[model samples]
Target: MLVQNSLSEVLRAREELFTRTIWTDPTSQLQNRVKGSELSRYFLLTESERIGIEQTIRLLVSTTPYYLSLSDPTDPNCPIRRMIVPTAEEAVFSLEESSDPLDEERLSPVRGLTHMYPNRVLLFSNHSCSVYCRHCMRGRKVSSSGERMEKADLETAFDYIRNHHEVEDVVVSGGDPLNLADARLEWILHELNQIPHVRICRLGTRNPVTLPFRITDELCKIIERYNDDNLSIFCHTQFNHPKECTKEAKDAILRLLKVGVSVGNQAVLLKGINDDEEIMLTLHKKLLEMRVRAYYLYDPELIPGSRGFRTPLARGIEIVEYMRGKIGGMGIPHFVNDLPGGGGKITIGANWYLGYYPKTRQHAFRSAVTKKIHFSFEPVGSDKESYYPVLSEADWEKFQAE
Candidate 1:
């Protein structure tokens, strides 16, 4: 009934949006600038995003006729329309995308438990986020049929994990784990802590970015109890720009750090959003400043209808390489591609080394023959050159002369 009602409202809203020509490619650009006045109040563009939206509109207006000629398409100019419309480019991308990109369901032995990697499991708790992202991998389920798992469902998942001794690490994630009520969350954490085999408890939530108000002092205290040696919190965020990193989000991250929850972020690499090296570096720096470690800079998942958002593999690699020596190692998150059909996350970043440098213990593997005896250097020849070789003395001398 709710979906039906929402769908009706969305349809009616679309008609109004299209008639105003806001759905037209060029007019859609004005969406961000329509604020406070008639156009903005109707469109729901936030103050932080308004300027960027308007700028995009201005550019589109000058460049494309296809965008300018379009009139109402039965919905307003918003992400929701972009996500649901089948004929849109996003829709085409979505059609090509898979719901279980990694084939997570095959690993789900029970209702909500996914045992993929060894000693680790992913638990689905709540399935609704405060603000749904257009490129959300779980968009297929979340707001529609795949709502939050009931307490009983969670208990069943817990039983499955308890019986399976192999599951030592548990990653509790859902639409956004933070959406659960504080009391319910605490209960879940307490139960997970009681399981001795569940050595590490990592949470995947976007609340710190979308709804920071949900993270209260009381919630931090509850988290502190489980913050011993094994427990950690992975605060997965969806920040795409410097503008998204607001002061409120920073404060939430600081509190998580203060409570000894090792905070880390996971960002989706979306096209036309944060596909640039500068944006990536800026985001990493901001996270470090907030004491949150950068974790994964994910290539947008191939969830059905999400193809439009993905950046090219080469672009992703380029971004990572640009940041490698430019910034601190701690701030550089792994650039990874979550392989289709459950192959699992694979690091796709630039390999600094063309080959492997066999690490030896006592001495450096150099041609310098000193009084050192027990160990000797082995040259694999230029054919088997592992990694970039250290600069030769002659090479260094020539460089100095230059």
Candidate 2:
């Protein structure tokens, strides 16, 4: 486990690195690096090659000084670079792509909310991030160029939650929740906490990785203030590669953990990034070291202009099966496919059949509605019959005679 110590020195280091970040422009990012103008020194890209990438993709670069410092400018295939840096390959568009592959726009009841599951609502509070990842599922819609939730919109969202008492959980997401000011974030959380039925609130962000300073002392206090006995607040972030587990990132996560807030990870299974099993195992193990649960290994969605990041489904199954029995299940995340056409996320695993038996209807824990893992929902609950075909004595005798 990563124990928190006197971080005065660590904080200073992170702060120094934080100051070196380049945002808004790719050209600025290149200039801030050791050798930015001389692109041929690092990447073998022509002037036109660079222009093509910038023109085709709605490029929004927000790479932090801390994250950029951990790169090898020599190796073109560096996983870290593959994540944030856009390339000419992005221009190679695919006909099978879409503006919203998961069809989130269709299910959205309000402007900022996507109500997919019955009891949970995904609330997009902001439309910006610390770094603009190249493989973002909502790259087209949330390009950071769009406006955030207005005051009236926030009130409307609260009203939506108040009216729908069924929404027990709300996931605050967008570009990243941390991108919003502390006051704005607090307002959102405070409103959600007021609802009697809202049990869990999760914020999906990438701030801690790209911008560690976002999880400040004040933010931690805000998280603590709202986390009461009735309502729980958790922060879920993404870490695709092990290189992202920097000292600064760990410190940021530790701050959240020390507070009443729980932290979890949602790693994207991207090609040329964390596609290998061992590479993933290390990344997840390191997450547990920082006290973050490895929650979901998501199958890259069929989004427009993201064909380059797609990996085979069979590889995902292979990794799951490899980890199921061989390794301890401490930090193993569920491999899931965010089913096309707004089907929602479905957990994928190795074939669960034992030659004669059919595919499992239950999850690893034997819940009939495996999707609702924690909830004691229907058929699988104790209210249901323990054993079916409870034959009477007469019926048993008649069957034997027959």
lDDT string, candidate 1, 1-402, tens digits: 001224455445545544654322222323322221222223333332343333321111111111211212334433232321222333243445676777888989988788889889999887765545556776655655445598999999999888888888888887677767778888888878878788888888876765565567877888898777655544556555565576767877888888877888788787766788998899888878877777888888877655556778898888888887667888888888878888888998664432223442111221112312232344644444344455455544443354
Please identify model 2 stretches exceeding 4 Å from their true place: 1-52, 357-402
Give the whole-model CA lDDT for all candidates, comma-separated. Answer: 0.62, 0.71
Q: Which candidate is the best by lDDT?
A: 2
The TM-score values for the models, in the order shown, are 0.70, 0.78
* Model 2 agreement with the true structure over 1-402: per-residue lDDT tens digits: 112223354445445543654443323433343222222333344443365345446445446554565655445478886765566666766788776878888998888888999999999887776666778888765655565678798789889999999999999998788878789989998999999999999989987776776677888899899998768999989988888898878989999988878888898998888899899888887888888887899998877567668999988887766566544576888999998899988898765431211122221222222321221222434333433323355544443354
Off by over 4 Å in 1: 1-87, 93-96, 229-234, 355-402
Model 2 reaches what TM-score against the true structure? Answer: 0.78
Candidate 2 — worst ten consecutive residues by lDDT sum? 354-363
